[model samples]
Target chain A: MKHSKISNLAFTGLLAAMALVVFVLEAQLPPLTPIPGIKLGLANIFTLFALYFIGPMWALTLLIVRVTLGSVFSGQMSVFLYSMAGGLLSYLIMRLLYIRMKEDRIFVVSVFGAMAHNIGQILTGVLLMQTPALFYYLPVLLISGIITGLFTGLAAQFSIKALKKSPISDSP
Target chain B: MTGRNEHSLSALQWILIFAGLILLLLTVRFFFDLSDGNRERALILLDGKTVRTLDLSEDQTFVLDTGYGTNTIQVTDGCVSVTDADCPDRVCTAHGPLTDNSMPIICLPHHLVIRFEPGHGDVDIIAE
Candidate 1:
């Protein structure tokens, strides 16, 4: 079945917009932990969606747009550096696994991506703060990464399944 | 398609994988936890550079001007904390005094961090 209805550009734009909205909204919540750089990362769902159903380039584009605009809208410009570091590392991990990932296995990608994201953020913190003590947060951040990644991964997996049956499934 | 199913780990396998990783990380954290001694000296850092070091043995207050903002660091007895900060959230001040060298008190907007300098502290004989 031919699944091309929405143009690729329009669909990518829509996904990018959705990712930005989620990113900014998530920032509003009081931090779940005093230990910085731990969050549910719901915005990653759209990046995963764009990558698998759309294309890698579109996924990258969606991620960049979301991080840039999300920081602006959230009124925390310092977050841009940390988010970019985490987002790029996360994207790299998932994209590397994309070819090997089956429809049922996108969650695995999300899980790994989320873990990488945390590592990237913590590393950035250590470098910026010039404090090696920040390494103490590693275990806490990694544990949060696994649990939250599983949640977001499953969410993206289910969303991908739904999109597979939609008009934009084969946009790539 | 050739590589897809070949690389996918079953749900049970992924669960075990995450479980093992979590266990491994927890163990590392446990070891790190034991390594930290009591807070003996407090150091103020701005933009990753050390600006001042205060001895906790001498209970005193120092107002730091980071150029970005100000953080009033207080050392009372063996405990240390940020009593006040010019940053909007002032979360550093709310962090209260730290009991040990576990985590640093930070002011995000001002790019300030106050933490204990390790090794100068006496060993925790109870843990040993």
Candidate 2:
């Protein structure tokens, strides 16, 4: 039993590390233009996978760890507070929706999560900057969220299928 | 059955939300009467440096010298846009004129950022 718990913890840590790698990789990509606020949001796949497969608390832990480590690695400690605000809100929203709404549709969840994430981030930006002008970009960001969320959702669905097929988890 | 019902409802909910957003957007686009209001402005930075302040009043055009070439920004009637650019992506130009509140005209290769500023002269946040 103790070994099982230790392995779970280790797995969670590994997932968080994987998330950080995704974040860094996404950051390194040439930012898409035409839409100023758009991003690949690569780390969200891990978060969603953890949410459904492992559990909400583990997902939350992975999210917090990933965000913190990603911030540290990026050397943008100044935006740490904003990212925290965004991350917390996103985690809560995903939890609420997952519990209250019974949708196995990862696509919808991804869209909702992405939208909520943008709102949280923009709100944090407003709070940090002390400028309501930041609200003006909310709509654009919302639209971008839907697009990226759909992409990540599809990726998660495939990953989940692949994981299910793996013989390593044959313990019924 | 419960899962199916919930999935359908959630889809409908998202659609309604997006519809409401579009309605709000159309209203803001057509009815607000921004013709005579105060024009917002943004600072354009290039090459990791501040280059100039741009007025989004449809009355000014500014040319920027990106390392690779040149780009032109035109502002008119409460909107700002990249009229021309030399980047291969031309994404900045494709963004067309920007009238939204917080976003700016950005050209990444040039390391340029354009974001809106409130007229009240508040300075609490710096762009990241």
Candidate 3:
């Protein structure tokens, strides 16, 4: 796994930096849809890349670092709870299913994890807002989750394959 | 671990699973939208509690100061909308009007949510 001069911890930090950069940059873009809580989630690429290429622990670390910094930089501290809930739920689901499926099927893991992420956010919103009317966004979120998950998943899959060509991989 | 299980499904199988899930969600959405648009009153909530009730029949506009932010809500033509707001995104202001029970007009920054109480919920005898 040490194909490069970078240490394991340093490499994890590098991935976290990349994830944070993407997260902040993506926030600059206006909402793609009028529906709230919907975004491309493009920053997930680096985290997913870490999950498949580095390790689950490193991936979790990257996700946490990215989301925390992302909220601070975006100047929207209110969304911090929703982001944490979505990020953790997605990571757990991805970690669970990634091992059961083939390595090439990263898209599947991404899709399911993305959906779980949406559900987690909406649940938090409902609880915090104390209104069941928020459930109305469930279907919209699910649909967006699948589409964005496939996009991020495919990007990560390609990056993983490209990195693997030089014999670089990690264990959970 | 290579992670190849006997029960591991192929790409096609995963697609089928996704399709089934999407179909189910669509059905749920259909039912949610099926509620008749006869709602006569809407609740203006701030931080999970109702602050005021608006009669959709009598069009009116008022400024709601939630301390966190402010929103100018307008009720017109049996619909309610946030006409203006000091929130960062102004998503609520842009939400136009909410006439049905499909989805509430939400202002995350202001912690404001305007939802229509369905016809079956109650009879607005006082409004009449």
Per model, how much of the real contact set is kept?
0.44, 0.24, 0.38
The CAPRI quality class of candidate 3 comes to acceptable
Off by over 4 Å in 3: A2-6, A166-172, B1-3, B36-38, B121-128
List the pairs of residues colliding in candidate 2: B58-B75, B58-B76, B58-B77, B104-B114
Query: Which ranges of candidate 1 are over 4 A from the true structure?
Result: A1-6, A166-172, B1-3, B57-63, B83-96, B120-128
Candidate 3 has a TM-score of 0.89
Model 2 residue B33 CA deviation (Å) reads 9.9
Give me the displacement of residue B20 in model 2, in angstroms: 7.4
Clashes of 1: 0
The lowest-lDDT stretch of 10 consecutive residues in candidate 3 chain A is: A163-172
Q: Give the candidate order by descending DockQ.
A: 3, 1, 2
Q: Which segments of model 2 are wrong by more than 4 Å?
A: A1-3, A34-37, A101-103, B1-128
Worst ten in a row by lDDT for model 1 chain A: A1-10
Tens digits of lDDT, candidate 2, A73-139: 8664644665677778877877877776442466677777887888887776555444444455566
Q: Candidate 1 at residue A4, lDDT?
A: 52
TM-score of chain B of each: 0.71, 0.56, 0.81
The CAPRI-style docking tier of model 1 reads acceptable
